[model samples]
Target chain A: MTRKWLRWMPAVAVPAVIAAAALAGSLPASAGDPLPAKTPAEVLALVAQHSAPSLSGTLEQTSRIGLPELPQAGPSSGSGGAASVLELLSGPHTTRVFLDGPSNVRVQVLDRFAERNAVRSGDQVWLYSSKDNTAMHLTLPADAGHTKDFGHYKHRDTGMHGVMPTPEELAGRLIAAADPTTEVAVHPEVNVAGRAAYNLVITPRTEGTLIGSVAVAVDGESGLPLSVELKARGQEEPAFKLAFTSLSLEAPDASLFAFSPPPGATVKEIEVPAHGTGHWGKGHWPKHGTESGVVPDAEDPAPVAPDAVPPDAVEPDAVAPDYRDPNGALARPTVTGTGWESVVEFPASPASAEADAMLSNDPLLQQAAVAVPGGRLFSTAVVNVLFTDDGRVFAGSVPAERLLTAAAAR
Target chain B: MPSREVPDREVPNRALPIREVAGTDGAADVGTAEPPSDRSSSGWPLLASELAVLFRRRRTWAMMLALAAVPVLMAIAVRASSAVPPGRGPAFLDRITQNGLFVGVTAMLVCVPLFLPLTVGVVAGDTIAGEAGLGTLRYLLVAPAGRVRLLLVKYAGAAGFCIVAPLVVALAGAGIGAALFPVGPVTLLSGDVITPEEAVVRLVLVAAYLTVSLLGLSAVGLFLSTLTDVPVGAMAATIVISVVSQVLGELPQLEWLHPWLFSHYWFGFADLLRQPIAWDAFGDNALLQAGYIAVFGALAYGRFVTKDILS
Candidate 1:
């Protein structure tokens, strides 16, 4: 009888062994050999001096805005097929990023059975969506030069951009625009993507703002920003984060950057009429309007809007500061305050019938938006967008009530 | 689900083969309990007979035909509809009208969560319990089929069903889709268009990936079958586990447990359709399935070897 009972021992033992093996594997690889530490200012200087230009890696991005969960469709096509950037409103996404100096960049947003790619080589940018098998091509104007001014390319992707921001880009933007009212600190040691790094923490001093503090994981060796995490005020967890799960400092293949639309893909050519660069999305993406032909003062896409505002608005200038232009080339995006508490209000532009219908029909948008006295208010962990009844938009990385007050004042 | 009623009838039909194969089981070995090696010594004959019995059933055929009907019904529905569905249905569903090939992919996606698993549960749960329930287990053991060989044979029969279910869905989908809609160059998930030949290859890979995905479930069902004399209970339990695993997989709060769940990668077969097929999910799924088979296969062995044949 004892021997018969012993027969069942294998059942218990096997599963217990397998579970132990899995638990061992999931333990984060020991933060091996911590790198020498640096102060927050030293890390900032390191980022300024960092020059590892050519690299390839995969990025994992997750958001915890407390929105409704994303559909279980499959890394979904980020800001592609649906032409609704809000489609990526929640959930984790995996994007493969490749770069080779200033001339070539490729970002592949992986969906379950589909992919969306944004490839930039020389003066050409090709955005391809495998779900619909469609490709959009845009040629940069001569003045948008191929020199190391990659910041121009970042500006060009103001609205409805297919790719998520690289950790380097987000970290740089946050650090570059850090004002006197912000404090910078550093955690001496940290590990990310299996590499030792410095955690540069930046906190805003002002109150009445939604943002708490932002942390950038700066690679100790190459000074690359391996990850960027943002916490909303009063939240322990990161409200938004984009980080590299793996990294390779070597240059990606040149062939990766040389993208041509697959043979059967429907190709649409976008002609940039005048402003060497303007926002790509007006409404529902790739609007075939060569009609915004008013040649402005050729402004180098100014750093007007505070980078933290994650407005769900489709318009880019809707979040940019509104400074009344004397020449009336383009109405200034109205920013109400300075620094962290700033609010940007949009000039009254009539919403198209199609956009109104689209917004009304999207279940995700409906769930996030609530009725206010004047209009509808939409919110995320750190940003708010109040769609005023009179065809105006008020947005900032502030609470919903602040945005409503700004809308009423306007 | 009326398929549950048919496996009981299978036991009676299988009685004839048992009599012919183990003709000398005269109940003399009932006391000392040495299995009478009255049949052939070779394991192949027994394995072949086990599989033959499983496939010969009306329930297996009914389940397969029902699975095949999914794509047929979908293709016909899409064909009968108006010119443009215009953003209707799930991910690959909208593309079905443009490319007939998408029908198989879409149908597979819809069925993976429910239909494939239900059939797998039935076949696997029916393996041992159905024999014990019909008073035929003593006769088979009296044929002196070693307990290990019988267990392996039962598992093989279950695994065989897993392969057929998904293939039936994919092949039927392709045939119906090609007949109804225009078939042309297949555009992959990476936007790369491949020739029809390559598309067929991708479909086969997807089918194979799905087959691997279900293998773990079959083992689980086989283990559950050993615990009870009622085949229906085992079948229900197996299906419940598959559904529960998927439900747990969907919850974000239990994300730490998701990777360990067998169903976590069930839909990952779609990776086979991508231009440069992502092989990571395939390898991981096979490893996870192997783990399940190892753990549950041993449990079934332990339980079945010790149980006294009373039915």
Candidate 2:
């Protein structure tokens, strides 16, 4: 019996070893491997290096800014109501972005059944929405005056505050926000868009911000941001997420940077107002002037005929005076706070008895409007609109109390 | 072992039937009982029979009636109201007073979320399991209707309900809306106005789009139906899944799951309001629905073909 058992031991041991080898082969090699670690400073440097001028990819963006239920009628005007911010942020939107150098860029925002493309080639930008079959041609203002001043003015006046940030933009802002007030660290490696990525977590040290931390996933090889996530204070899950579902390092085709109105499309020409010289306490405001500021692009041979102007075309110089009431009361807007927490206040309008009576009579409007100390407050996720009893309208990305304070200020 | 047991059980039944027939004239009795050229063997006949049986049911008529009544009630309510509430409902709701045809579009919006999905779920869930519960499925299978063919017939019946339910709502809404409100050129979401003829075409497209949206839920209900013999259980499960998905889709925290959820693109029909017709979401919705159909349809096929028809 001992001899027989010894003879079978070799066979049993060999099969056992083979089974162990097979199981090992089936297991992932990187299962227990540690992620590559780097310092916060190194991560920041990598982010700066990868902020390339030319690149293109498909971006998937989603936002949940904790918005209240909006009234069904939707925003009232072209500028959109307060709920428009919620609408823009709450849903999933796919944007095909091409930045073949910053000056020539195209962003195609795709909706379920519609497509809207904003293509900027050289000085001309064409916005075409396939749904309405409408094409808007905007002639960008000429690169006149100080580029830096104009850049600053554009950055402040673009009304991009509180809007959901793209991956690259959010990455850049996170880097800029890095200071003594922020605790920066490099997180473990994770997969994003099918590529290995390292997350750079930026946590605010300040107590006032609603944001707890922002995590940016940077591609391991290319160093470009693949995704950005933001978590509000006391929340386990990120409140906002924007990421590239797929990306290509190769430069997008040059043809995609150009736009032409399709056949039967109603094309409308818009003249972008130039940055005027008027400065109200360091902030530039558009001055009411007759200067066309329409620097004809040398590439395009078609001259803009004066008669071709639409009846409602906003004269560039006539922008400033429009802010004034019939009584010549100028409602100059002023900015307060800095960076992400900035707020803009528009001068209060003198309340009219007729407007007061109308507000009192409309029960639906009364129900919709939130009563404050002096007026009503309409709030959404990222923006708040305050309508004072004295007829002043102040809108910003701040809370109701902040807007009220701005309204009450002398 | 289970496969072997299935044949063992079936063999005894087959022998008993033959023995009983053998006591009489074996050949004639066998031939009459199992006809070589049964009409049910054909696909079209089976589908027609299945659809007829489905429509004959009281529940089928009741569901369709409930679906059709929604638009009528909505039109009456809107017309009865003294003031046209702005920014209160869907984009088309605000414009219903301008053109009554908008009532049809608004009705589609109201139904697509919950009501239409619930109706589709009930019909699809009942399709296969209902037969099984009544002990008729075994007879149908033995009629040599072919398992695949019978499944397809059931699906077709469910698909029929899906298409008809929305059409009823849209058509009734349009007729009532046109009667109560002014019908004229329609202004699309793009703010560009189009002729009344074009608007009618759009309304048709809206109805078609809504029907396609239900394909995912129908597939889910069909798959669930295959999992159990209880029709009511399957129906409830299908509806519960839809509501759960919608709820999950609304959560900001689960933003990553939105695209994969069936309910995510249900609202894509709104893109039809655009002038040139937004094809991105339209195409995406179709592709997503097709994906769900392929997945769940395969699951149902895989399970049903080999399933022991103990009932």
Candidate 3:
């Protein structure tokens, strides 16, 4: 009997040892964050001076925006699938991003059982959906900045935090627009992707704004933005987050930039006019974007027209030209108030019925919006858009009451 | 020798009664319950006997046939029907018509979620309990197999099933797919084309990955088998764990628990089909499986060595 129990020693010991090792592995590295002290301004400079021109990393994007739970995989997911802009917004997605500069960039949305890849090399862009085995090719005009031309992807893909803009681009916009109503401070150093980073927090000093603060982690060594997190006013959890889970500063294989549709793939060639003549140009809105700037991507920062905002003359309130919305049926889209509290107001469009129908007919709007006294308010953690009975639309990163007040005052 | 069905069960078990697994006979203690002396007998011959007993069972053959039918049925359906609209069905379903090689991949995908785990659960869960249930377990303990040796042989037999099941599905998939669809170059997920030889190599790699993925669950099943005398209970519990792990994996709320889930890397084998073949997930998955094996293998050892064997 003693011998029988003696044999049990290894069984118990082996598992116990493994458990101990696993416990050690799961604990975050206990080393102190090793970085010299830096002020908020210093961190801002770190970002401006930062240019890791070539790097490959995997980024995870997750949102708790309170959108209804949509089935993640459906028949439609196969064709447009997770790459569909709305689909991208709803769930957690892992994207592998490889950038060799403005000329060569490949972003792969790694969906289960399928992948949707957008690879841009020189003037050519290839969008391939592995699910359906279809590829779309577009050749850019010589004059349009490839960086700006990629905006068409975000332009059509309005909503969900500037459609895959790197943390650098998003954080750059926030820092550029910092004003008297903005409070920038450096939190204690934190670690991101195994790199020490200065956590720069940008708080909105103004009241009545949905934005609580935006925190960006700047890599201490490379000065690159490693992660960006946005929190709503009352929410303890970040409403939207994008961060690199793994990163490598080395340039990815040059061959990854080149894409040729496989032999059996059904490839479609998308036609674009040369340079400035096409709507795909930076200064122009892609055809669909002009139809509805109501996309939630329009809420924060300035509109898609960053250059349209005068270089040195940003209104103290940070109001620039409102985003393009040809279908809004209202010309003269304007902003009222200032700082983070600004509300974009569009007067009742001439075609009220069409605009009203557009609002009422939208499935997302109908599902997300709750009827108010005179309008329906569609609210997310970051943006609230109100559609009044008279076909006027008011939207901002402010409370629904603010939008209603603006509508009533109008 | 009333138990003629078990072949050479009695003498070997009595010849090498390990101190740990020597069973107390409630029905008939015919042989001396002596300390283990034939430790050297716990070698290749014992494992060979274990495997022969396993593979010779009609149930094992039936399960193998059922697994092989998955890809055959899938290929025949796709071939009989009009082209499945590109985005309408299971992931690689549409690709199968374009390239016969995809039938193996798609079949593996479909089976990994349920069928493969179910079969693995049966075989692994049957390890000790099936012997115990048949009343041969006690005899085998006295027959020549020490407790540790017998446990090793049982696990090896289950592990053997792990490799063979996926290979069966993959090879059967290839045969039927080639017969029905056109065989040619394969288009990888990265859109790179590879010769048929390379594609076959990739399929084998996929099979290898799947074998690793299921090995962890096999360990879990083996441990569960030792917990109960009824094989069916152990089998159900083992299969349930696989399903639950997959369900938890899909929940975004449990994102923290995901990296630890065994099923987390089940589909990552497709990374093998990428252009340069992303080895990161493969490495992570192998490490995770190894961890599972160590934890459960030890747990099974601890339980089986200490437990009283009455059958």
Candidate 4:
């Protein structure tokens, strides 16, 4: 009997596992349906079973910018003193930075790519580069400088605050634009880099956009992105490649952090004293911009009529404001989109006193990072923006003052 | 002579004339007519006998040897090569060789695109035309063999050679590939990786599919061969047709129509390597290839049976 059972076991066991898998795989999927209520430890163990024995080795990948034939090995931009190609590639440049955390913001330029790169702190700013060896001046907006108000890792329940929607959030937005009933699953996981990451997979329940299903990989550790890949509806080919390099978790060195006036460099610091010259502290009007002179919507709140306010008041009185007024002032601005927000640390240093004086002229960042805090030298500010479905910018503002202050405190 | 008992045992000695049979006479009358020279069994038997005649010519043996030897050479070369990635060599070589949807399809791809199909055309091209060149076609026709059967025997020989040639090439390549590469399992597109044994099973199936693809092309060549008097012309024409189809198939702008083209099915064997085996599309490809074979076969038979082989 035992021998017969052993023979039958081989035949029976093979089919049993397959049967189980088939049944399990075909089970109706319910929203947020947990995978059989197994412990997290058990899930990890099951996943580990299938993973191959990984060889531990660091992979170093370098991609050179393929430039057309050059007669010389030096920089050909004509504005620069002769510099190697590597120097040119690594120099001050604006790169698209995507921070995916509580309130996401796409920083068009994180740091200036130039001979001298400068990072702003509240009361001080740091400037370092090959071009400037001497004391250099830092600049900031006069009234609306960097503030640490918006850079914390606000949890899901925290009210949304950001200029632009994150890529993951955008997935649903885009799908919704094409067809409603599209469902998206967002979860946190560890990526290949061993960093905590937020993974979002969007599937359309009804019709889908040109993009059928998309998975966005956001780094939960740094609240920064490692890569982005777009998967088209029926395409087998990869549509695009987006990646980041030279990621640093630690702040840069302090000595190199501060901006200095380069030797023989003429320093001119323009300091515009903070003054409440307009209805608002800054030149920004809810209706009209300073430069473009574009008019805002009729419903947009405008500066109160001078006669409607009491003599002592600097602004409008909301009490008994015309009820039928189409542009009646609202108490606070509406928060329109989803975003990620997280505080990250960077080195805090200041350029020459002249540079700090120069930064004071900027109207939006006058009070940010006035003094470094003990625990963190950083400040925070909210970034707000609206974008089209395809990630094209409609309107946005990244408060450099807030970002710079936050970096200093951290 | 005693006619009563002698006739029961002994046959009539006098010969009958065949002309008298036409006049309602018996075989005795018909037998006397001159022997019908037209009824002689000279056509196919004569051609079959000429199998030795082919051997006498160095080129025939060379052609056969070349066909047989090329596969061996390819097998040896593939085995000798170390350029392939470790563990993937066999599957890759097998893919390049026996797989009809893959290897066979690729052969059609490479051949049809440039000059490979032309070689198939050469054999087909020479079938009737070569015989005409040797003047043996006329001689064979004079014999009792019908024009249809004569064309058929030639077609069979040509197609048989075509099938055998590719089979040898594929098997040799597979053998070399197996020896050189680590053949334990293969990763398929369906994401289900299989062991070497499973891969081998799939490989065989794929090879059979490739054979089907080849059969269609042979039919096409045979049909083309019947159209021209010059063997070279027929071979070239067939080759040109293959080339044209391949070129036409590559026009991505005409994607919908490409699937209907016969050459479109050339890549069907590649489907075998796909895990979970996408049989629906592969099956459709096979059916399409079968249709081509049938259509071409019918056309060849129709033309050979009815048309004159005067040239």
Q: Fraction of native Cα contacts kept in each candidate?
A: 0.40, 0.03, 0.52, 0.00
For model 1 chain B, where is the 10-residue window of minimal lDDT?
A: B1-10
Q: What is the interface RMSD of candidate 2, in Å?
A: 14.5
Residue A197 CA displacement from its true place in model 3, Å: 1.8
Measured on C-alpha atoms, candidate 4 has an lDDT of 0.37
Task: Compose the digit string of candidate 2's lDDT tens values, residues B66-178.
Answer: 98888889888888887464334454565677788888888888887789989998999987787788765655554434556667778988988878888888888899999
DockQ of 4: 0.01
Cα lDDT tens digits for candidate 3, B69-114: 9999999999999898766667778888888988998888889989
The better candidate by TM-score, 3 or 4, is 3
For candidate 1, the docking band is: acceptable
Chain A TM-score of each candidate structure, as shown: 0.81, 0.62, 0.78, 0.31
Off by over 4 Å in 3: A1-28, A31-33, A71-86, A145-162, A275-322, A325-332, A347-365, B1-45, B248-259
Provide per-model DockQ scores: 0.29, 0.06, 0.40, 0.01
Give the higher-DockQ candidate: 3 or 4: 3
DockQ of candidate 2 relative to the true structure:
0.06
- In candidate 3 the C-alpha lDDT for residue A109 amounts to 65
Number of the top candidate by DockQ? Answer: 3
Taking all chains together, the TM-score of candidate 3 against the true structure is: 0.83
Q: List model 1 lDDT by residue over B86-186, tens digit each.
A: 23455677677777887888888878989999999999998889888887765565454556667787899899999889999989988888998888888
